[model samples]
Target: MYTLILVLGICAAALFLAGFARGLRNAVIEYRRGKPEPTEVPDYNYVGMAAISVVISATVIALVGVAPMWIYAGPLMVLGTAAGIGVAFFVERPSA
Candidate 1:
């Protein structure tokens, strides 16, 4: 069970990296085509991102079980909450 969770976590991380790469490629292509500079970060669909993150964390915690929960849950929740807020701030902030 733990091994499965680890593998899933790795897969999730890989997918996230691939997505970031794809977004970077798209932005580069747009820039190369002389498109008007994007005035914003683009709509990130935070609901989708949040859902995935929650699922990943939940899966991890379920696999890790209760003993480590005390150690992991607090930090994960705090950091995840902070990251969510940070993303929102960036998304909402006007582009300079």
Candidate 2:
């Protein structure tokens, strides 16, 4: 039973690593193929800018000891949510 579990764990780890390596390899290939194309810059809307600015302001405030946890937390969450939804606008799409 122990041997079986060990073998299965090794197999799972190997498969996971192989898949991760393949993804990195594909990303490199796609990046190389995309080099000739013009990349679109991610434009920040007011809300996006506000989120980023809030985070920056919070960090600066923290350096001054005037910031609370929520000061950073709220802005970080805002940026995190925005990044989740808007990452496609920034990243290069691989050519078919």
Query: Against the unseen true structure, what C-alpha lDDT does each candidate score?
Result: 0.58, 0.57
lDDT, model 1, position 53:
84
| Candidate no. 2 TM-score | 0.35
- Give the C-alpha miss distance for residue 27 in model 1, angstroms: 1.8
Record all residue pairs in model 2 with backbone atoms less than 3 Å apart, i.e. clashing. none
TM-score of each: 0.39, 0.35
Please identify model 1 stretches exceeding 4 Å from their true place. Answer: 1-5, 38-68, 74-96
Per-residue lDDT tens digits for candidate 1, residues 42-77, read 666699889998997787777667576555554445
